[model samples]
Target: MNTLLLRPDPGHEKFGLGPFFRVEPLGLEYIGAALLAAGYPVTVADLRFRPGATAWVRRTTPRIVGISCLHALEYDRIIATAAEVRRAAPNAFIIVGGHAAASYPAPLEHDLIDAICLDDGEEVLPALAKAIKKGLPLTEVPALRLKTDHGWVTTQPLPERTSLDLIRLPARHLVERHRSGYHCLLFKPVWLVETARGCPHRCSFCSVWQFYGRTCRERSLAAVVEDFATAGDSIFVADDLFWYDPERSMELAAALKKRGVFKRWILVQTRTDLITKRAEVMAAWRPLAKDFDIFLGLEAASDSGLEGITKDSEVTDSVEAVRLARELRYGINGNFLVDHNWGEAEFQELWDFVARHGLQRAGFTVLTPLPGTEFYEGIKARIPDQPWSNFDMHHLLWEPKLGAQRFFELYAETWKRSILNTSGEKSLLDWVRQVKPSQWPYIIRVLWQTQRMMKPDAYMTEHALSRAPLPEPAARQPGAIVRDEGGQP
Candidate 1:
């Protein structure tokens, strides 16, 4: 093979991006397709499903080995996996790419990884592969970082992909083992398709705009239709904010419906305000390419909290959006921000909002200052001893305003209220509907992850003692305590 691409596992003991959700490495596959198009033979191995992945890499003697570290949490695993790759094949050119690589390359500038592709690997990966194949000088590849004896050197930033219409479909055939294993929770074997890349909005907590330089380049409707048809039924439109142009989304829906591909359910992420303002879009969604579930970026319940992160929508927009989704019989995954600065009242307020919406899923995230974002440089060193894993959003890196244990307790209680109560009926129904023996593993894994979060200590990746002290249990309200599954309420 000319090049071998691998997606490293994010080393979360209880949960993972792959095994937990069964998501395929869409970006890596896209790069693989572009490389193959350039006459370079490509092989992809998603290490999550490949148990003997190290041995697999050991055997492959490809000229170039490319690995992806898409999330910051995968930093340790990326380094370890790259080190293993080096040990297995010292002669191969090792290139690390993805969002994490571009955001934080200083820590990854080690002896194992030879080069790091800074951004959009579609153009850079193929170019690098072609250069390696022809033994050409590597100076021309855009958005590239090289490790030198003294320090790291970088090339001019690559222009954001202007023509998303030209990129080929991701080579799904490359990782066939991941096909059945890829899914979103109980939604078995879910496929991923993208309508657009990059976001126009400048959310402070997010680095999407910074990574793509505030660009919102979208694929043509025909290209999107083709991609949807390629992915078949049950797709996740992996766009950061799919609500950019309401007319475009409606046009795509019309195309999907006109093609008579109605059985497929798509999951998309978008702002709540879009759903509320564009009622016609939601109306079109019912028959033509209707969304199965929408990841609504309702990042906060309070307008003040929303403003803190530069979110444009008000609290009422989220409420109205959720109401519309419920009326239309669609699931809403309401995402909210959970900060260390929150007290008991704030957690309660968030829980009340979720409960009021009758939302089945509630996603929470700590106010992380992700690298390449406007807030990163300010708070990167605030938590001196925190490992990169803490940045995954489950762990609290800073001292909590309500103290450590109280904050974690509130977190667990609020999560249980959302998970156990908000969607218990649907969960039970899903459990009853599943007939495949293969489905149990996924369901059980999901259950275990959910149950683990009930305990405050489950969030502890490192020493909890390093932060604020846990308050006495006697001081907390009886209702705030997490209930045992088999125990009384």
Candidate 2:
């Protein structure tokens, strides 16, 4: 093999125990396309589905091995894979990239990983491959950190952003064996596509905008339509914020309609502000992607919590977004944020909101301070051990008003009671009744996964919080302590 690419797994699988987990790693696929365009033989080992990845690396014996460490949760896997690859193929040059590596490359500076990519791998990986083939020094490669005798040295200044047309469509055909594994809620064979890159929002818990150079860039509308046409009947436009610019969204929709292309099930994620504020844009997208579904960033219902997370919308905006989805008969997946700070009442309130709104799909996760985000920097010192496996958002990073076990019960029991009658039943029937007969196998697999998740032990073992450290006491100021209103000093 000339070159082999892999997407590291997230240590453990917690499928329906919490939020959705495995989606295609578009970053590696994009880089794979670039490598192919640059005239290099390449293969993608998407370990999310392909088992025995280390054995495969040993068998292939490629000259260059590229691993994508996209999420902080997958950092543990990155370390394990890098070490195994080094053992399996001692001569292979291992290069690691993706959001986690870009954010915190120091942790991966071990015995294996030859270099860490600090920018978009689309152009950088291809450049490195060329340099390797010609026996040129990688010391001067831009947006790269080569492991030297002293330490990792930064080569060149990282570029801000790359043109979206850098490589048209990811090398998705490479991972076609696992095609049946991807889906959005009830829909099977959901093709994940990116119409644009970067996010404009500054939500404190997220780091996507910062990693993408803190700017919103669009793929030319023509490019967007061309790519959309190829993603079969179901599509998931994986934009960080889809309608960040309403005009561009409308233009893209008009272009798609002109080409006489309409996907049966279209899924996209955007903020509630877009739905409530720009109703016309939602209306326009209806024709281009009928049977449209939305993943709304309705992070928190309380204004204080929303402000804490820097989520730009209000409770009212989320309400309006839900009302509009219900009226339009569009499927809804309203994601809400929760943390250990909450007592039982807060979870109960969120549960009530889902029931009242008739949301067909919903997701809730404990707020984790992932690396690369401001939240992580603020709380890093208090966290005793930075176990990458515990960063899945299912585990709490800090101690709570309620103890960890109580918090888990509150989160699990509340969701169990609220979802089964509401979104759970509705989504199950929708898939069984409407999906193509050929897709029954995939649908049945998904339902089985969901059913297993409903059992009590799944989240307990899968998302067990024993690994999470308790929150440190508040730091005392210079001034002496004083008695409070309740006489507590």
Candidate 3:
């Protein structure tokens, strides 16, 4: 049986951005490779890179078509693409998987999608492929949900692969040609590598641990180094949580050094607690930084805000990490989530924290209740709209304790104020002029993007006016439930 894997373009145009492309759909590539290895004809098409995606799907008419929905932001595009696929291949089985599908099963139950794969698609896809090839009933396939006679029926859960080493390094050859499109720190061609999967931390707002399990899993050092060698100079380890295991991190660093993979800059994401406790470990792993920068998620500015988000690190640890990164001369990108529970005063405190830490390159996102996360479960009833696209980090989906419009307005203002305040004492344009010649284009683009974002017209036009009232959620009495140190339920 012929199977075609489709990953739809993110439709950046709809989001008011130019056409942006992904290096390759690593998740889809893995599932494709597994199917191919099992002696089935498999073709992978990443519509993000390829133009005329629907036409291409029509041309490559296969018995089954699968699309990966990694981000909630791409929900509209994914569903639309699936509808096109169904039209193109009427008899074809349409399957949707990845983060979005696993998180929000109800969304995928529309007429466009025939089956939804929950959790990891690695083992699930192979079983699905075999079932399709043999004309076996799909209802028997584990880790899959099918539109049945009654309603959506889910099979037994697919076992999560504990041994990362057993899984082949995702089809690197299939992605190698498009490597330049996927860059680290944006704009630069960088290879994306995942040395690990899942997170050990139990942050309430995150769905990663829930999807990939709480225990961290590691890819073999040799396999990682091999992939790194193919990745050329720069590498971005896209692990949900790096540095969860100090020994594994050190071993990987040593392997990179030994294999001469340290030539290009390395970018990684980790928690503040890990960085604070393992400062020496970070120092020891410095060889990995010969070309390495770090990104740490500082969810909120105050401990109360942090506690609300259930981030393991305190505000102090965030400050220390920034200071250490500055001392080490590592490129640091700190990510902060503007909590819905925060009012204007809390927002100012966040900005003050960033200014105080001297963190220049920072990412600020409005807290979104992504499906499958504890955050979503806690606030689903209070969500005014179920529009998946609005769940993108940029938009506010739920009715915040504060007014939603005010929350968004404050968020946009805070970002502008932070950027202008932090990028030297000069004005926005003045800061752009001061940027190095090589970095001029990027800086200008960022400035333009920020200006566009800050414009009152853009904010008012994109977001809904007059906040939609959500169903009143059951109130939680004070001290009704006690949370652990991590604030996880």
Candidate 4:
């Protein structure tokens, strides 16, 4: 039996350009690699890199077509692409998985998608292929949602893979086949690798814990090093919290060094608390630091706002992490969740903090209550809109405690202030200076991109607020309607 794994094109929208704009569909790669390891013929197509995906689908012709829906914004496009694929391959089994599908299985249970993989697809996908090869009904597979006579029938949970080391490195052949015109940051070909799954921290605003569960899982050091070897010059470890285990991180770093994979730069994300407590561990792994960039989620400026989001990392801890990263001479990037509950004063506080710490290469996202998160449940009673696209965190979906217009204005103003701050600019220059002078062109390109993002008028005009009135909570659908075992509805 032949199987084709598809990653739907994430439609053109916010930040859909530059290094950050690249689509690295590691989920589809994981499932495809697993199926291939089991001796099943597999083809993977990332729609983002494919022109006229519907036309490409008509050409591939496979028995089973699996589409990954990584982000909610890609829902409309996925549905349309699935419909087109069904038309081309009438007998094809269309399967949908990923964060969006895992969160909201009920809505996607319609005729467009034949089967939904609820949890990890690495194990389930191979079993699905075997069952198909043997001409067995898909209902026998665990962690699957399929259409029954009545409606959707979901099977018992597929047991999570106990050993992360068992999963193979993603099928690089698939990535290369469709990689002629791909985008990456810094002009270098970039590939994504996963060191672990699930996050140990339970940040209230994040849906990772809800989807992947709370416990952290790590791949064997040898397994991770082997995977890193297959990637390109740059690798992004797409773990929710990369350094959750300092000992494991050090061991992995040493292993990478031993295997010579440390020569390629690696980017990873971690919490502020981890960075502070593990500075020595990070220093021990300094051989890899020149090629390493770390992203920290310092969500809020004030402790009250931090508590609201259940980010236990104190403001002091965040500042310390920034200081430590600078001392260790590592590229540092941060993402801050601007609370809508704050007025001008709070926005000023955030700007002041950023300037004081010289955090230039940072992202400022509006505090959106994304579906399947505790924050979403807490604010369901007062949410103002159903514009799902606005849930992208770039737009303000709720009627802010400070009111909508002011919220947007303050957000725009804060972005401008943070960009123009002298201290922030100097700090970025310090980082650039650490790199070889020959790489200045690439560094300048990224800086230009950052400046474009910082432009107030450009961003405001592009992501402007609609003048429509806010919707009443009573008029909105209940939260349960949009939620399922996998994740958001």
**How many collisions per candidate?**
2, 1, 2, 6
Residue-level lDDT of model 2, residues 120-203, one tens digit each, is 798888888888899888886778888988888998864656788666578888788887776665566678889877887788
Which tens-of-lDDT digit does each residue in 49-134 have in candidate 4? 64555666666768888988766656667778888888788888888888778866655777878888888788888988898889
Which candidate order results from sorting by TM-score in descending order?
1, 2, 3, 4
Candidate 3: regions farther than 4 A off:
12-23, 160-162, 398-405, 418-447, 465-489
Q: How are the candidates ranked when ordered by lDDT, highest leading?
A: 2, 1, 4, 3
TM-score of model 1 vs. true structure = 0.90
- Candidate 3 residues 369-460, lDDT tens each? 67778767766667655566666666655455566667667876666654433244546567656545775676565555555545445655
Q: Candidate 1: RMSD over Cα atoms?
A: 6.2
**Deviation of model 2 at 141, angstroms:** 1.2
Q: How high is the lDDT of residue 63 in model 2?
A: 88
Each prediction's TM-score versus the true structure: 0.90, 0.89, 0.87, 0.86
Show the colliding residue pairs in model 1. Answer: 22-182, 22-183
Worst 10 residues of 4 by lDDT: 475-484
Q: Indicate the residue-level lDDT of 201 in model 2.
A: 78
Error of 2 at 336 (Å): 0.6
> Which 10-residue span in candidate 3 carries the lowest summed lDDT?
474-483
Model 4 residue 186 CA deviation (Å) reads 2.0
lDDT of 1 by residue, 1-489 (tens): 468888877766442223446578888888888988888888888887665456766666778889898887777788898888887888888999888888777667888898998878888988887777677777667788986665677877666463676688888889877788777755668788788888888778788887887788888888777777767567777898886789897887899777766645678888888889998888787665444788788887777667667777788898898888778877787777777666666787788877777764876666666767767766655545456676776776666667767877887776776553325444644663553675876676566565666667766544353343432322211112122234222
Model 3 has a clash total of 2
Error of 1 at 402 (Å): 1.4
Candidate 2 similarity to native, TM-score:
0.89
Clashing pairs in 2: 399-471
**lDDT (C-alpha) at residue 326 in model 1:** 75
Top lDDT prediction, candidate number: 2
